[model samples]
Target chain A: MAAPPHFTGSLGYPPSSPSPRSHLHCLSPCNRAIKVSMSQNQSYWTCVTQKIEDQLKQLIPVRPPLLVYEPMHHLVFTARRTMAPALCVATCELVGGQQPISPNQALVVASALHLVQAALFTHEQLPLTDRPIPSNPETLTHHHAFAAGVELLTGDGILSFVYELLGRSDDPAGGNSERLLRVIIEIARAMGSEGMVDGQYRKMLCSVLGSEELCDVGWVDHVCEKKEGRLYACGAACGAILGGGSEEEIEKLRNYGLYVGKIHGLMLYYHNNRTGGEEKGFTDLVERCTSLALKELEGFNQGMVQTLSSLVRASFWDKC
Target chain B: MAAPPHFTGSLGYPPSSPSPRSHLHCLSPCNRAIKVSMSQNQSYWTCVTQKIEDQLKQLIPVRPPLLVYEPMHHLVFTARRTMAPALCVATCELVGGQQPISPNQALVVASALHLVQAALFTHEQLPLTDRPIPSNPETLTHHHAFAAGVELLTGDGILSFVYELLGRSDDPAGGNSERLLRVIIEIARAMGSEGMVDGQYRKMLCSVLGSEELCDVGWVDHVCEKKEGRLYACGAACGAILGGGSEEEIEKLRNYGLYVGKIHGLMLYYHNNRTGGEEKGFTDLVERCTSLALKELEGFNQGMVQTLSSLVRASFWDKC
Candidate 1:
């Protein structure tokens, strides 16, 4: 099959919000933070995303095995904004030590992370039943049994691809295979059962158990750590691992990732709840996570970490 | 969750066959060949399977994260017979060089391959429609939405776990990381889009497109090469690569794997067709793959490759 015509080189963001919420609702409180952040450092994030997309375009195959590769290429290259890849790149720069991994390798890992998130996004949005109408029309079409199958398998394929890329070069970045292997294992562990998948399973249970139980703030926080926080944190941690950060530095960056991840999750939760007139300790939780994230970076060079600090500040606080 | 009482160490194989055909149908002409081979080397194949299972039981986790880990453990540890892992171990021994890869490391890689196959098997059998009554009641239950989610994510999680295991050791088998990295890449490439997933996508399309079109022998053959052949080829190829096999030995084992894999796929295809009164060049195809596989092993010591030769001969020619 010939490649799709619209599959041009330019990074045109798809016209859809990837969040689980499906509403024509007004700007979420989270978006208000984004609006302010964008106004202040719109160009910065734009350049970051643009660079990632350019690298991604070069990385993915543009031709056949269109069924598998196209889904992944479109998912990664066409997305408007992706925090995971951005966080990875930013953290890489923050922790750039005596000998850092190449920017190309960093982008390759980031892009793979993005593909995992995209796969989960697609899987989650698949219609629970093979019905005529789906809740989210944009994410998946229930018209074919194979569409879900492709998405599911493609997701599995990309997960394997992440390792394939990691093990791509010999003595990559002049680092031994053992170090790279450690990095690969670390990332996989974070994304595996105890991390992202666990959180997802918990959330699924909460939804089935219904709203009365969903309001258990502790459970929400727990899920937040797993579902959103772990991946975000993982993105930054991967960057640190590849950047040749010292053990202390890696730990610091990981803590920073965990806090920032929590902030992101809380903001998303706040936004979803705001529309439903549900409120909790949203601001308090956000404040705590933001402060914790900031504290982790205090010992590091402020100049190199500014973009990440700014990104987190803009994601949570009204002012940077 | 408490471990199931049936989680005994014994290798009482699951009652179900891994084939797509759901009906209680007799085997096609393929088993006539199996009957002859099994009759001759019945004790040999049984011992190989038993040894693999003993190692598998020790390899899998026996405790918590029951939802995620249990599915994987059960799938891998319980299956009666699998060609992937068997081919891996067999090929490793066949290519025993001066300083062969340690048996522990070979088992590690073999187990990972088994996990990938099990994951794919689980995902393929998942209900396409989330209705109460599925075509195959044995595979999945129609309970919580989380059930499918868990199965899908568990499949994905195991895929990650495969890589995680590869990178688990610091100096695996006293071999440098470079060789292990190569083995990991080879396996990933075989399982990725171009290999297993590609064939799976084709089969899904055929099912969705159901007609005489599904019987288009060329497309079916192409799918067979991908879905079944690559993984088996990958398994043996990985063994040869890791065992310090020379280039010629590696190529021979790979060809042997491809042929055996095709023979296996053909058997399943033939069995699935018998109830439908459909037939193709089943006997001819089996004869050709079997002969080609045996030819690849011709140069090796007769005693060294007896199990493999017997496997091929039994799988096709009837008498060992």
Candidate 2:
């Protein structure tokens, strides 16, 4: 239950741990390999996160109408963005992307991907259920409700802006138009009703209908696969598609992404909440998924996949 | 203002309009020409509305986890969609659209446009303001907050699905890739932070900052022009872009959409709210905007623009 001392503050996983919700703490770079190739990967992760952070800051400036842009800027910048953007940028590079000619494309798309993820994160803060409000009601102040209201508008606004970033082809006559359009569709499919939304909806259902019954071993795995796993899959696939990877390569990256996300989400959410038997099963799934992710990278040039392998190995170091 | 006996339930403009909040009643088709071109226009309106309605129903089916789709379906289907869809369909035909070879594209884009507008409409129902929630906070039920919560998630979900609809290029190899991408970008600009979101943000600010002073003549005009007007403008321009119109044609349709939306929104929300002198000024503005809309269609064939003109005249028939 203790915090991973070296990993706590690195990915915004809340410095104070020893809490049941400390699963997010274990997702940082493994300290066991911190002396060698891990540092290189760590630098890449740090460098890319800062780049995305700067680009996001530029994308959402502190303009007038502070109330609207304020929450949008806050939620996006403050999210624990260790998964999607990193996967996207790493995938883009791993596939021999057009780094010399046009590297900004990946950065832009990666940042936009972060925007969609952040919007979903904002939505997670909302209360959900069709049956009834929970029995205990807090003395809900008007300001609190108003804050929630601003967040609602801010979430919708961010999603709309995500499309704008992806679809705004600077040069319509360029050859990348088809690729960009396809990337947009891929992100949408991953984030729409069948993917993230469905996952969130099901998660809500589990909470209401009985997490004990519904979020069993398979349910948690299925939800992770559909929800966060699908998100990371689409993000990596988008990077491959944009980086001029072949269809086969994009599929490989996509499957890898799916595995990474499942491992990540499972690690983040279901540590203490699971029964010991369920935990064992979940742990087995994580090992299996991590292996599946690395298995996807085997066909690629091993020299090129260090970054990606680092991401996969990140979730389970000593266990593997 | 008793629901304009002939209008009322036609446009979902509540039949009982004796209340101060009755301006939405007046946006129905003007009755003066009901016997002539009006009937033809009415038929087209009904037919197109039905088509968009059917397309929307197919786009969002009743599936599992009714909690997610229920609010989305209810909001999209129940909105009084008399403005954007009408302008989009009418402008597409007026611009000599390729209706014979491929008619579904315009309908699809128009329907998607309605989805964005509908999502924004759902957000409007949420309480806004950085200030206190309002006086006389009644016995706040948990169900109400929970409904708002579902709607919040539904709004973001709908926006994400919209990009999927726009960017899911069925035949990516087709020559329409550029046009579709451009239309997607156009819609994003109109609905993003600077367009619909900004308009909503400002509208919220007006209510909190003092509707009396902040929402004076020019403020109202600007908000209408930016919020609803901008929404309609993008819808029509998307139609023109997808319909294969020239740059000049798309710009013209965009301007016309701006005017029509302004007239429709002003009519729907601000008749009783305006002072006598201000009402006259707004009436003059409406007339001028209507003329501007017609002027945009002047370069097109006279026969081709009858539908467009009918929509323009929809807001200010007797006044003009």
Candidate 3:
């Protein structure tokens, strides 16, 4: 199946909200996507997404073990919004990287990010015994037999693929191996216990404890950092590393990613819980994340990072 | 809980078997452990196991996210029999390495191997939803709430840790990063779609298909190669890489690992299906694998590889 319509990089516009852009104060990403003539960055985003798609297809071919590979393919192709890869490439360009848009280090790391995300989604969707995810045939068409087993192993397989991709080096003598290793470590920690996995565990814990209140504003925000923030945070940081940014620049980008990640994560939380759209502190959270994200780019060349800045602020709907 | 009584690195003795050592003419690994006096290699094995245990603890500490970390810890600590790490260290020693047994490249790779195995076991044990593995409280003590979610996420978390561990470079300048990269790539492939995951898919397919005949001797042997063989093959090959072995030696060690892995996999299969003791082609397969594993060491110094040879041959109940 194709991507869910919302996954078109469009921040959800909650129906009950008085103003669609009240919280974010920028044009919706989906809307920006449509008015390509309005902003050149729209086309840039499109190109970056296409690059990611081509690289992903080349990296994960349709081989044997159709059971695992097909799910991995579908989940990645569908779940990917061009968000992570675009951020990676856009950051690379910002740092004046050579071959910034090519199938280079930035693109490879972004692909691995998507794969890790696919693995996370697979594990999260594990169903009850009798009720398989296949029951929602619309979501997972053709994933009938051994749905649980296939998904479980598919998640594990994709993770292995992530390391495999990262372990590769352009220089046979491994001149770039150390850089790649740093990326691997950073991404691993983000996705490992302290970051995404911990967030997931907390989220799951809330459900098991049967207390929505347990996911208080602060608690949910922390979860958001792990689940969504870390990926974006790592994506940006990894991009900076590939672009050969200085230590401070890498740190600044990572912080920037964390803020963007929070905004995206809160958006997800709001999307999932539509009824809770007008809940307290929700808008405040988004506003805080957006301003902080914008502040991080202050240290960089303003002209070089215009696209990245607009991408995070979700302002290409008009500003560009 | 401690490891199941079976994980003591002992080859299972079929009750119906005419002779305990009739098929392989060698002593069992478990028996070797008991009679440590007979073989000096037994002491080496103990030291290796202790090292793996210490590294695992250091790598996976019990801090926050106890839900995921706990399961990861339990699985690694309980399930690890020191077989994979032992093979790695033994190969490193055989290849004439300095600091071979210390916490060098070989040990790091071995630690990752055990972590990956823990992940595999976590995914493999996803229970029928209503009946959580916690129902077998003895097996998973104090793991009552959100058992499925915990296990699923725990599996993903551990896989991330594997990359995290592999990504670490002891040499600040990454002098050995190239070799580590090779080891990472090799292990990833061994556990990727065409290897362990595919084997699992086929094995699960047999059950989902509900055909005993589907898992024929040949099919099972192939399955064994993917599930068990690939891990050992990668383990030995990785050890050779860290030990600075020649390409030819690494290749041979990999083949040796393949043979040893198949033997171990078949033994697991036999143990799981105790009643299948009198089944067809079991003994012949073990005998064949034993001979093949031993032959791989012929090109090296006999004295140097005496421990490595006995490891695969399962001799030294008397031979040592």
Q: Which candidate's TM-score is highest? A: 3
Tens-digit per-residue lDDT, A81-142, candidate 2? 64777678767776767444234677788888888887887766544324334321211211
Residue lDDT tens for model 2, B68-130:
677778877765475686567666666667544225677778888888887787766654323
Candidate 2: chain B TM-score equals: 0.80
Task: Name the top DockQ candidate.
Answer: 3
Best by lDDT: 3
* Location of the lowest summed lDDT over 10 successive residues in candidate 3 chain B: B17-26
DockQ of 1: 0.34
Model 3 chain A weakest 10-residue run by lDDT: A17-26
| Better-scoring candidate (lDDT), 1 or 2 | 2
Off by over 4 Å in 1: A1-45, A77-81, A97-101, A130-146, A169-175, A275-280, A316-320, B1-48, B77-81, B97-101, B130-146, B170-175, B275-280, B316-320
- Quote the lDDT for B171 in model 2: 58
- If the candidates were sorted by their lDDT against the true structure, best first, what order would they fall in? 3, 2, 1
lDDT of 3: 0.68
DockQ of each: 0.34, 0.34, 0.43
- lDDT by residue (tens digit), candidate 3, A1-320: 11122233432222222221111111235344654343444545655666777889998876655666677777666552526656776676566566423237788888888888877866776664523333222235433234677777777888888888888744654367777888889889989888898898887676566565786777779988988889888888888887788888888988988887777676666555534434547677777777888889896765445556555555222111
Tell me the whole-model lDDT of each prediction, alpha carbons only.
0.63, 0.67, 0.68
- Model 3 C-alpha lDDT per residue in residues B15-92, reported as the tens digit of each score: 232221111111235344654343444545555666666777888877665656667777666553527666786677
- The C-alpha local distance difference test score for the whole of candidate 1 amounts to 0.63
Give me the iRMSD of candidate 2, please: 3.6
